[model samples]
Target: MNSNNSVFGQTLAQVHSKFIIVQVLVVIFLCVNLLLIVTFFKNECFYTTTRYILFAVTLLSDSFLFLASDFIFIFNIFRVTMQVSLCSVSCIIVGLYLIVTPVTLTAMTLERYVAICMPLRHAELCSTHSSVHVILVIHGLSSVPYAVIFITFFASASLDFYYQYRTCSVEIFFLYKWQDHVKSAVFQFYFLIMCLIIMLCYFKIMKVARTASGDDKISSRKGLRTVTLHAFQLLLCLIQFWYPLITSSLIHIDFTDLQHVRFFCYIMFNLAPRCLSPLIYGLRDEMFLHALRRCLSCGLYETK
Candidate 1:
């Protein structure tokens, strides 16, 4: 009995140590994303446009998504019970952020297409005000489904005041119910359509990139690179968010059977984009890179 207890104690200590390390890594990644956003603030026209504003919104939403998910994660780790309504609202916000990201990327792709394929009309068509309104509309549209379902389902169903799982997602407490399945389907379908649109836009942009004017060639090449990055990023989002949800639904596989794999996928789906997007988007632009380099030279990033 003493030997068994000793082994159990050692195992518990190892698990606790791993948990703390994971938490620290989470905070560090979140901070790196924040730093990426900060680098965008500079004396340049890139930060002035509505397009860049929309890009910044994506960065902020990515960070906010991780913050919400990790907040629930930490609370659950500590066994902190929260009211059902509050948890619903918080998770809904996180869901909206996840949805808004791909929608924003779709908009960005469309903007690039117009700038490259319809150059004469690009200015009036892709104004800053219009971009802001599009983002607002995305937020409204993404929230509607979650808000409607949360109210509709919670009204009729019995639920505990405290969270039943670490994720604070309705699918956790609600299980394999209709609403849970429907919500996942809606998000997956939305991302699928967004992925198609992004791909189509990039295809047209690629054509324009090949046949370009002497003056337009540089800008065309830049657009080509940016859209290609967007396509890969969208594909990653599809794989991370859409595939797991769809595969799980279709196979009805026991996720618990592969605990480590599920957790790694979960962390990737939640946090990888937050770290990757800043680098992908920022580094793809020569101007942003020059600006970042200048900031580094001038000590804008100096430790104060």
Candidate 2:
């Protein structure tokens, strides 16, 4: 009995530690995202430009994702159960942002491809008006997958399911075993298409870089690196979707060991991907960094 008590205490401490760590990371990223967003609004050039506009949308999606996921994480840590209806709302919001992030990343990559590979048509193809249409299309596409899942939920779930209190998770949508397989297959196909598009953009940009000179060459090379970062970010997002398969393979392991693996994967795949937007855009892009620095300096001067 004494040994069991000691083990329980240790597990409690670990849970507290994990909570604190997650909160700290979320706060840091949210603060950074807010600062970059402010800088984007302060500069007319950034707000008007197609590339920066897409970057801003990516940041906005990341911000919303961080908030929604963090809410779920905290609830799960405390083992709080809510009505299925409430949980469904939170889960749906999280799902939308998750879908939006990768789609926006793909759009950003295509924007770069046009800017470098078709310089003469870049303005006409990627104009501010066109970007608004692109964003609408992205959100529209992101909504379709969730709409199908919600339809399944409503069709399969009895009325009692809505009033029942349960811990929120993606699993709530899986009203039947077949739904899980369908979800997995749909995601697999979606990601395969996205992966192909990014790869194609990279190869096209590479060709442009090889034969180009001076400013055009430099632009194409930078675009290549940017697309590579997008691909890496997409891979991280993809892993979260496949997380169930990863954990299922470890089912034979001790329960505690399995929990530890899940925690690590949550941090690495879920939290880490949301943190990369600032690194890819705010710090890596020379123009944006310059604008951000100038905005910060001006703010500091005004404060003084």
Candidate 3:
């Protein structure tokens, strides 16, 4: 019995240590993202109207993500009100922003595709006013489904206060019943459809890249690199953020079967995406890197 108690104590200490590390990493990442956003905006002379709009959307989405993560980290550190009330609102906001960022990314990808692949007709197709209108419509349309889900889930769950030293989550509504199967099927179908669309876009892009002549090679290669990196980042986010959550919601797995180490892994999976996104863009985009370098140089000169 004494040996078993010692082992249990050691396990709990390890879990606590892991949680603290995760929280620190999350804070560092959020700060870095903020700095990147500031640097991006400061260096721009006159951003295209569409690019400005997209940046605004990205900023809003990332800000919400940062806030949600920070709140979770704080709640984990301090045993705050464990009622799901605060978290429900945060979850809804995060969900809406989560959907918004991807929709913006898809629009940005299409914009790049059109600009590069159909340069002759780009002026007619993607004017500033048209781009603004399209962005507004996309934001409104993509957000509706998530808003509906949030409302439905909030109404379905009974509000009872509970205390626990962990971040709050929306109660998995379809964990055991037939509804679990239905939800999982619908989610998988949606993900599959999105994957199909992304793959189709990539195929066309590759085809265009292959046919481009000597002078176009450099630009084509750059664009392809950008798209490839963006796709990889999105893939990482989808796998890390959505996969486990969806699986847990779908499968009625026994808690006893889950290793405690998995809990830290799950937290890392969620936190890493947000931290990595700005880093990916900074590293991949020559324009962004140039601008960042210029800004840093100017700052150092001013300090001198």
Backbone clash count for every predicted candidate, in the order shown: 0, 0, 0
Model 1: colliding residue pairs:
none
Q: State every prediction's TM-score relative to the real structure.
A: 0.81, 0.95, 0.78
Whole-model Cα lDDT per candidate?
0.69, 0.86, 0.60
Q: Find the candidate with the highest lDDT and give its number.
A: 2
Residue 294, model 2: Cα distance from true site in angstroms: 2.0
Pitting candidate 2 against candidate 3, the one with the higher lDDT is 2
Q: Enumerate residue pairs that collide in model 3.
A: none
Q: Which candidate do you rate higher for TM-score, 2 or 3?
A: 2
Give the residue spans of candidate 3 off by over 4 A.
49-56, 73-81, 127-131, 154-167, 172-186, 240-269, 300-304
Candidate whose TM-score is highest: 2
Q: Candidate 3 at 110: error in angstroms?
A: 1.4
- Candidate 1 lDDT tens digits, 1-304: 9999997787667557646866786788777666657767765576556567777888888878877877766665445767666777787877788677777777888888998899898888877777768888878866765675666566655655344434454554353366666766766677778878987987888788788878788888888888887777766665655544654554455533343454465566666655667666667666666666667667754443
How much lDDT does candidate 1 score?
0.69
Candidates 1 and 2 compared by lDDT, better number: 2
Colliding residue pairs in candidate 2: none
Per-residue alpha-carbon lDDT of candidate 2 for residues 61-98, written as tens digits (9 for 90 to 100): 98998899899988888789889998889988988888
